[model samples]
Target: MARVCVVGSVNMDLVFAVETLPAPGATVLASSMSRSPGGKGGNQAVAAARAGADVVLVAAVGHDDTGAALRAHLESNNVDVGGVIALPVPSGTASIVVDAQAENVIVVAPGANGHLSLSSPRLRDLVAGCEVLLMQLEIPTDTALAAARVARDAGATVLLNASPVGADPAALAQLAEVTDVVIVNESEARHWVWPVPHLVTTLGARGAVHRSAGGETRVGAPAVEAVDTTGAGDVFAGVLAAGWAADPAHAVRRACAAGALATLVPGAGDCAPDDEAIEDALN
Candidate 1:
């Protein structure tokens, strides 16, 4: 299995179940409420591990109970949390609202996650040793760039999942230079000007598209009843990184199938499909 090291944010998600998304200047009541461990980085790490990869999360949490539980959750998922540090501030949090259709809207409060950076020599050593470096935009862009540079220098593949894609153009371009594979959704890809040779754009329900030197290939997702799409994209990125090391040709397709399976449940951390489940969905 490929060894993946993820440098990104870790947040506790406060989720609300609603019949539909609230429009602007409107108020709605939630049918139910739940909380769980989540964040783009944490979700991807769990996704990779469940997909049968050796994964480590290099991020931070607060010195609070939420942080403790989130750390424990990652360890329970077979992800290495040795690199997860503790800061004095509160743990990061994401307030998510999931509609009946499983689509969601989220707002994040980056607490200790904002403190994670490449300043720690421990992080440097961690990124250098991994076979693949996976990252997302929830953390500082400079930190992402630092990890990408270190991993690229170590001859490791760098996979960057650009979500909530609103990074500075110059900094984003620099990160793109070191990134070996770039993953984005339809909206992000539309405005993505980075000249990344290898890119994958995911279209919800419609499936995904892969663009490379060999040209573009489209893969349709498995037909599943989506319950919540909170972390489906994170699952896609993680599966792609793990599968790329073993079977690049089928990785995207395998990942798309896994993503579809993820939407069958709610919450980010628990929704990631295991190897057997992913295989079953793909078949």
Candidate 2:
């Protein structure tokens, strides 16, 4: 197995369940309210760890009780929290609304996450030690770029998940120069052309489309029933990283199967399936 480093965000998700979303200023009663451990970085790290990757999580959380609980949760799941910095202000929190159909709306207040930064020494160390460096936009752009550069320089494969939203074209291209594989959905792919030929575009139920490194071959998603599509992309990235680390030639198909299997469950990181489960699906 390869060592994987995840640089991203961590937050306590306060969720409200309702029949449907309400328009501005319109009042609607929520059927239930709950809290869950979430954030793009944490979710992806958890997904990768659960998928059998040796994972280290680099992130930030506030000094509040929620932050403490989040750290405990990550530790319990066997994710390395050595990179997480706990601060006194702006505790991490997100407001999420999920409808009966499992559709979701989220608002994030970065809080302590805004204070997170990765030093050059730390970056170099992590890049040197890990086989794969996975990142997201939830952290500072410069920090994420720095980590990618170091990982690329250190000869570790770099995978960037362009999620939560799109990126500027110039920045995206620059990032691609240091990136080994780029994973995005159809909408994300449309934002900028990738310089790296090993790109994968995830298309919901229709499956995902993959362009190989040589840029001559392609692959598509396997058959599966999707329930809640929340963390499918993260699961895809995690499984893909695992496959690439173990056997680069077989990564794409195995990754697609794990991602599709994740869709059968609900929630983000919580939805990622074990290796055997995904392999069984692939078989």
For every model shown, the clashing-pair count is 0, 0
Q: Compute each candidate's TM-score over C-alphas.
A: 0.98, 0.89
lDDT of 1 by residue, 1-283 (tens): 7999999889999999999999999999999999999999999999999999999899989999999999999999999998899999999999999999898999999998888898888879999999999999999888899999999999999999988788998998899899888999989987767688789999988789999888999999998889999999999998998888777768898899989999998998789999999888877
Clashes of 1: 0
Give the Cα-based TM-score of candidate 2 against the true structure. Answer: 0.89
Candidate 2 regions off by >4 Å? Answer: 23-27, 216-227
- Write down the worst ten-residue block by lDDT for model 1: 189-198
The sequence of per-residue lDDT tens digits that candidate 2 reaches over residues 1-283 is 6799888888887878788888889888888887878887887788778778899888888878888988998897789988887888866788877677666777888887777777646645865678899888777777778888888878899988876565566777788888887888888887777778587887765667778755544455666655556667777887777667778556777677777877777566477888788778777
Best by lDDT: 1
Worst 10 residues of 2 by lDDT: 213-222
